[model samples]
Target: MKKSSIIVAFIILLISVGWILSGQIPKKIEEEETDSSLNNITDNKIELVKVRTEKSVSKKFNKLINIQGQTKANRMISISSETLGRIIMINEKKGEKIEKGDLLFKISQDELKIRIDENKARLSSARSQIDERKSKLNEFEIQFNSEKNLFDKGLSSKSKFANAKANLDSARSNLDTAKSNLALVKSELDLINNELEKTIINAPFDGIMTTGHMEIGEFVQPGSVLANFIELDPILAIGYVSEKELKSFSLGSNAFITTSLNDKIKGEISYISPIAEEGTRTFRIEITILNKNFLIKDGLTTTIEIQGRQVLAHKISPSILSLMDNGEIGIKIVNKESIVEFFPIDVISDTNQGMWISGIPDTSDIIVVGQEYATIGKKVDQKLIN
Candidate 1:
């Protein structure tokens, strides 16, 4: 009975092992079939990159130069005294607005009037001497004529006639000397008047006085700066341009100016430096902007927009720019063959809408989306975005 029981138990264990093996064999076959199908799909499939494109339109755009500069007064000058004297009166103060020929300061008229009066007296004395010499010359001429008539008629000695002629010549010389002295005295009087005029200083032009508060009794010399003056109307906008950008500029070109305070003004190119700056190697450009109200101050930082020639350009978002393998910045486009191409661009100007760029085809289809996946000179599957 024990032997029969052992054989039956062994048959039951063998049936369980056969059932487990039958289930695992089918599963292994299914896994192998799945792996084979995946390999077939991978081998013969083409990789396609999806990208969005836009049609570029050719349009005329203004080429512009965006630069920074500073404002300057149209005319700046240091007013200096032309003569030496002591300050007796102060007519203007610093920061005062003055008109042309306005008195700025007064120098002490030390002995100026006395000198002029002395010259006048000397002129009077010379005039009286001139009249007396002329009367004596007339008397000598009459006597000489009488002596000459006597000598010609052989009625008088040659010595007597010669003496009379010498007297007349001396009188004429005295009269000429008197006239010269009169002229000299007159010139002296004129000099004194000119010096008197120099005692008072006046403004050269219509401007604001930036300096001068000379107190009374301050001694000043020739060429001593008495005040600072500036003309603010029609202010100057000065900037520098590089060598490459020099060709785009010309005198009288129109420009737009903006101040740091968001003030926009219109201007024109006034002066272009003939020589380059020594340190920067750049040419200086000056623009004239009307400031009739004198609202603009000098030395304030400014932004200048100088318009250049009109050229064909494309305006696009800045994100569309890409970098090539050579580290060049550009945009990617689709050629006529629907293949990817690269074009380098120059940024002309930036606006609120977009960046204006040059150096692309007049008309092109540019990749807008999935541009990272697009390779230059490769076929692409372009997808347009609405």
Candidate 2:
């Protein structure tokens, strides 16, 4: 009777186990079906690269050529003595502002004045001698005529007529000599007057004296430098342009200048070199700016910005720029079909905010974020940035 009870208990346990297995099998099948559905969904839906994009629109961008330069004076000259003399007066001090024709130095004029007076006296004497010689010539001419008439009429001898002719010839020669002497004296007087004028040295233009004046009573000779002068009313900003940039530069174009002292000024392109420099292959350019206050100084460091041709360009942050496999600089953009594309661009100009670039469509969707993950020609999921 115990054995029979055991068998019946085993059967009951097996049936219970089978019931548990049946319930687990359906649950496993349901789980497998859910997983298969998930797999199918994943396989059917294409996974794309996620990226952020910005719509860039092209506009009229005035390209600017920025060049390093320096400030220069409009004109600079070394004032020098044109004659030998002793300095008697100095009218302009170092660093003094001078006007055109203002006397800057005075040399001793006593000797020149004396020479001029002597020449004047000589001239007057020469003129008097000429007058006396003319009178004598007239007298001799009249006597010669009278003698000739007498001789012709047989009233005077041949020797008497010959003597009268000689006298007339001598008188005429004297008059010519007197006239030559008068001319010589007149020339001497003019020379003396010119030397007297040289005793005073005046400013050639409105400028500032950059050098100290010679002390009074100091001797100076011709070609001796007296002072250094510079004209600053219209200053020049001088710069150089590369060979590639020379074609776009032109005379009379507008330019902007910024000095090391942070002084900003507007100017016009006054000069562009026709030939390039021998070694540097660069052309020189000069911008003229009015400096009535004389604040701009020579040799000051400057940056010159000259406006160039207008072009359609897009302004974008430099961070978005990328490099291609061939080492070309470019930017990645999304096409209408949501495919990523790499486009090479030319940098037009740069500013504080962004860089202007060209060589792309007038309107484009540029990849702003996740550009590194973007593959060329691969479709991407783009999100427009606000």
Candidate 3:
């Protein structure tokens, strides 16, 4: 009985210690939960994002279109022969400059000359025949008049007068036939002369002879190319313009060009095609530039710049550009409420200073730094660049 009573007292003491420890543990855990709640609240508070921005200024933009082209001779042609003959003389050589009417080729004309001589002889003979017929007609008329007077005065027989009249009529008819024959001969002579002239070919215009297709003693036929001639005093620079840029150009528009040979040429837009090319949908354009020295040759690669009208634009650094989630290029700006905003821009051109752009506001605070960190329509803490 004494041992049992001692065990009960120990159990009671253990219960009392347990109750005290449970009460203190609950209070300590409550304090820790409160502190954790306070930390989470602090973390959830929104913090302002800092960014670097610059106020955009508007400037007049001089639009310029850059295109590549090639230089061409103002006039290029292949001179051909009009008659068939052996080439006997070449007055101008290849690469020689010549003026209009300068004799370029001479075909063998011995046979042609003989034909002309024959025609001339025939013409002279025809003329002599016509004169002889006219003289016979005059003599017959005189005889007819004398016969009629004699017959009226009873000095001649009727048969004789009738014979005289028949002779005069026959003589007049012969003269008419002779005159017709003479006209035919003259026409034939003209044709022969024209053929003779064709034997000597002359330059059609002022140009440089680019080639000599026939050598001495070579036989050439009609339509055979004798040489190539090109006029280069006013060089043509040919190029194409995009459909979107077509409206920006017109005939007589001033342009500047640079060639592969480092030649700077000033020119005017001489021609603009009314129709677009089928494949590229581009319009053709030609610029006329003076090449008096003939230094600019054909087929040289060239770059041209055509100046367009002036427009209002903003200049911004290339780094300031960004892409939206929708894949549009734009710039981020700070609005009047100091909120991040996006404005799409069209890049007009690139310069040493920056990119000249359009389609943005005339005045804007462009976010140069931390643009990616800010969301559109969200407020930001902007740091202005001095």
Q: TM per model?
A: 0.80, 0.81, 0.75
lDDT of 1 at 134: 93
lDDT of 1 at 155: 100
What 10-residue stretch in candidate 2 is worst by lDDT? Answer: 89-98
Model 1 clashing residue pairs (backbone): none
Indicate the TM-score of model 2. Answer: 0.81
Show where candidate 1 strays beyond 4 Å.
1-51, 260-262, 381-386
* Model 3 TM-score (2 dp): 0.75
lDDT of each: 0.87, 0.90, 0.88
Residue range 321-369, candidate 2, lDDT tens digits? 9988789999999999999999999888989989999999999999999
Model 1 C-alpha lDDT versus the unseen true structure: 0.87
For candidate 3, lDDT tens digit of each residue in 268-383?
Answer: 99999999999999999999998877788899999999876677888888987899879999899999899998888877778898898888788889999999898899999999
Model 3 has a clash total of 0
Off by over 4 Å in 3: 1-50, 131-176, 335-339, 381-386
lDDT of 1 by residue, 275-330 (tens): 99999999899999988667888999999999877778898999999987788999
RMSD of each: 8.3, 9.6, 6.5
